[model samples]
Target: MSTPLDATAIETIQGFDAEKRYKHLVKEVVANRKIWILIDEHGCVMLNTDDEDCVPVWPNKEFAEAWATGEWDNCKAESISLNKWHSRWTHGLEDDELAIVVFPIQDQEGLVIYPDELDYELKNQAKKQR
Candidate 1:
């Protein structure tokens, strides 16, 4: 599960540009300890961009929930703690050559980054929080 976000907060974040949202996502994910992803019956959703196969992530359930429309309507917003992300996801995604789209919104795909890049950002953000 992920932390609850107020509707107004979600709306505010939704208005931010992709990079700003990505920065906010890194900060909030570090603070909250949860990285939100969307999953359906089969497994995690994968999006293909021109250059990468990306798994989208969000800072909170509200942001993740906002993406679950149309084809992803049946998907559920699930949380992966930062610990699990560091332990499992980074290496797994790196080996699979998958990128991450951070905090995507209805109008745009978010910042696309390599798994290790995201992991590094998360660690740096965590350090700042400390």
Candidate 2:
């Protein structure tokens, strides 16, 4: 079942101009192969269910590893390409009441921050650590 949006997640979404930021963020993620944690409003990691075209993604192995160990209070963390994630998983979400946030893949090492504000080298390093 889809989870509800929480206060922090709502604040994050409302803090940005979604229409203007969505395309730019997508470009940044695709160009850098950056990992992002797709969290619903309630801070639950978005997962790939029976859907074929859509899959949940993390920016790096570190974040994925944490989620796997229930660090994020969840047991599953999956990865998907930015293209499919944007076009498939997130499709129609903009019109729904539910809001999703693209959080930078962060671990104990450091934070990747946001999708639009990612350091390519740092992201790559995190991936390599996996």
Highest TM-score: give the candidate number: 1
Candidate 2, poorest ten consecutive residues by summed lDDT: 108-117
Per-residue error (Å), model 2, residue 100: 2.4
TM-score of each: 0.95, 0.35
Please, what is the whole-model Cα lDDT of each candidate in the order they appear? 0.90, 0.41
- lDDT per residue for candidate 1 within 10-111, as digits (tens), equals 778888998899899899889889899999999999998999999999888887888999999999999999999999999999999999988888888799
Best by lDDT: 1
Tell me how far the alpha carbon of residue 99 in candidate 2 is from the true structure, in angstroms, after superposition.
Answer: 1.9
For residues 2-74, write the lDDT of model 2, one tens digit per residue: 2334667544543544342343344445555444553434643543223222223343434345445444554
